[model samples]
Target: MAFVGMDPERIRKVAEQLRQSSHQLTMVNETVQRLINQATQAWEGQDTLDFSDAWTGQHKLTLQQCSEQLEQMSTDAIEQIAQQEKTSGITPGGPGSALKPGDVIPGTTIPMDGLTPDKLNAMSPEDREKTLEAMTPAQRAAYLASLTPEQAAGLLNGMSPEQSAGVLAMMTPAARVAALSAMPTEDRRKALEEMPEAMRDEVYGAMDREVLAQTIGHDVTLAKTESTLSVEAEAVGFKIEAMGQGEMVVNADGSSTVKLHGEFGGGRTFGSDEKGASVTAGLEAEREYQFASPEDAEKFIADLKHAATSVSIDNPNPIDDVWKVLDSGHHVDRFGGYLQAEGHAELGEFGEIAGGGRIDVLATPSEDKLEASLKLHYDASANAGDFAKFSSGGEVEVKGELEHGQLSKIELKASTNGAFGAELEGKSSSGALLTTTHEVVQGSNIGQGGEVKMTLSADNPGFSQVKEALQNGDVGKATELAYKYSDVSYRQTVNTVLADDEHSVKLGAFGVDVAKAGYHFESKAEVSTLIMEKPAGSTHYYDISGGSR
Candidate 1:
């Protein structure tokens, strides 16, 4: 139950498997049910946030599934005709030791030989109904389960609609599938054919898709996505950003022909206020393309990066030499070797850090790997984190994989010094939905810190809540939700610098900087993630934002 080292995902899978096999292994299932509860309990009160995080939906599903399975794990109750719990919960018996009709049907004393098929057929429907009504629901279920597949089918098909519904209402879904499985092909078809439309559809819909597909050759194929990539995008009032790769393969006896496709959208806007005008001012799109082979996809991906390098990397600059080093064995692409940026960033949770950073990357396409280092020094102005215009500097080392058109995996090791000293590291996989982001965190937390891991999904409820808040013109509510949502799990160490290094700072109660302190101390969250949309699935884009406090 103390699943400390055990992977939660593995535990979740095992619980699922046990729930499915609970029928034949009842008591063990009960134990597993209890264990699942324990495991769920372990997740409570773990994080410090007012709103739900990424795992919110999954945790709810786990508990709901556990409860449903518990209700269905009936132990040895159906084997005996007079079980206290009832046969409604048990597996249908096999021919080896199945109970006879007389044993299962309450108060029926007729000998098996005397109650011939002919005699049963001769009985009036009213008399048959009366006989069935005499038995308890449990006994009726047992009687049905005890029959051979053929006999069970005969009984069901012979029953009136009202009787069939009555029996189905009492039996569990598992029992129904079992009973249906035992029927003869033609008889099973007839039984289902007569089922109420809704009931029939429900039963069939619950069946395994693989079986259904294989049975009827229901092959469904979506166009292949050749590649996905991340983009460095800019948006004005009217802007859009999208990148994609897809392809169709048409074959003939001779050879397959080639098809080329690509898409791009981006925008830019400068605005002073938020207003409900000019819907076309923003640009966004989902694009698809086709490629002849994976190589074609790779070429497109590589070319995009190459174009980006040419646009951003200027000639005659020291950074160009970094590009030469990057292009030693291969041409640098989007995440190419040289990156020099000069911009002032205002972190929402944390205070303002005004500075630029330089990035140098060594990419080994032969090894499908990339290694990069980045350094940035900043002069921090007064921020919510109590920084009094201190100088800060940091470095980050990244090792990652270039797969398809994206960084499939990345590992970051980083450190910071100056007003605050800190060390951080994390790993990220876009395919896994979320990642651990490493930043130049110089212990400047006006807000809290942790190795915050975020899982991204279009269906993520936390993200959805934030989106809804913003849509409803609730900026404050949206900010709070967004911060709480993806802050998954973070670890913070508040570096205490002796007051000897203290300086004066100011605070405002209502839009006016009225209060001043020497070397101010307050928490400010160095927040990001407002503009960037965390890619929901695998794409070529860098799955990380390189700059954070």
Candidate 2:
């Protein structure tokens, strides 16, 4: 079974994406505030309020107050998100690239989600042995803690799963117990579940069964934490009740199998893994939460494929290569000059875009151009009523070529559902720009009207620095650079929304409309991720409006 679950890497990816969305929204909000302030100022300076000066000032004050509230709220929300990121152990600015396996510091929260067998195996053969000899679990944990989290993550990611486990197994039993005990319940259990049976048994025996039973689920179809015992905590949830008694079966592999059978109503078997174990229900209400089964090692490859964000992420190497590269504990954005990427989408017309986020691309060199497939998510749903959500709503796919970083040729096709919903044949080709200005002259009402000729550094950031940081997995670097290097041209649409206008409609303080046109522009810059050189199309918008009365 493959683990297409919320692993750490995936979590970081999703969070980073959301953060970007938040920032984009903030920019839109600021634009609106600017427009409101401008409109009030224009009325006071250019148009006659028709009402008393106090009336005009009141309206201006109201607008100003409203702007402040919104600005404060936005600021607070952004800060809160930052705090959450820190709490979640998300490395600032990048995919948790800084987190290392060795970061399992003694006193800090231990992170074991990234540890996999492949990572251990990839380490220098002697490295695991060296670590085992060099440090006890507490010592190792402490040593890792001494280094940066990234360094720890790096050390762990570089080793093979066995190597990593071996290191952990070497922890002085007391240190192991302390570290495991200190871990949050879910993480401790999950980490133990991922370890080799011997190592797992060591820690598992010490875990609080109540906590383990509470947090762990019974569905092992996805093989989340390899050993099926993780499911024991949820046998009932899986609809399997304990039989008269559990049986211990001796396997030819010298592994011990704890056979637990209860009534589960399904008819067919859940199928076997690369290992011969199978879970049967209905015709046989019995399932094996077997420990004697041969440990599955290549399972992670299946996981990588299952966890694939886009079809393009598949590399041009042996299946093992995926784990090997991931095991290297280094950024692997591009493999052999090819990169795989994904984005979010919207599901159910007017429904929450909760699960609709989907866009995938694989960029590869084609002669002097790039070859890629751009897939866009159109709809999605869960098992609410009749059918599963995604089964019905597929995607719009564009197979295209780009010349000199610009889209050149393309072929597009949409799923029948997508085509039907959009009223198109579900096929199309597309190619897809941004400016700003400020001026104050004559129409000035007072010599005090300050010319805020403040130049906004309009220089378009090449995005090279941020993009480079992104590729290197230095999210913190990437984010810092993104701010240091920004794209201002995109917001010019805000001008299309509204700008410094003279003599616009004014709402008199007396609630009477003064003669004049009110100026306001609802400008919006679409925020979206580009895949296959085609923008998924951003529904995010920003607008500004203001006019003097």
lDDT of each: 0.38, 0.34
Largest TM-score belongs to which candidate?
1
Candidate 2, position 521, lDDT: 19
Worst 10 residues of 1 by lDDT: 215-224
Per-model TM-score versus the true fold = 0.24, 0.16
Model number with the top lDDT: 1
Q: Candidate 2 lDDT, tens digit per residue, 498-541?
A: 11122222222333222212222121111111111100111221
The residue ranges of model 1 lying beyond 4 angstroms of the native Cα positions read 1-58, 75-130, 158-163, 170-172, 182-549
**Local error of candidate 2 at residue 282 (angstroms):** 50
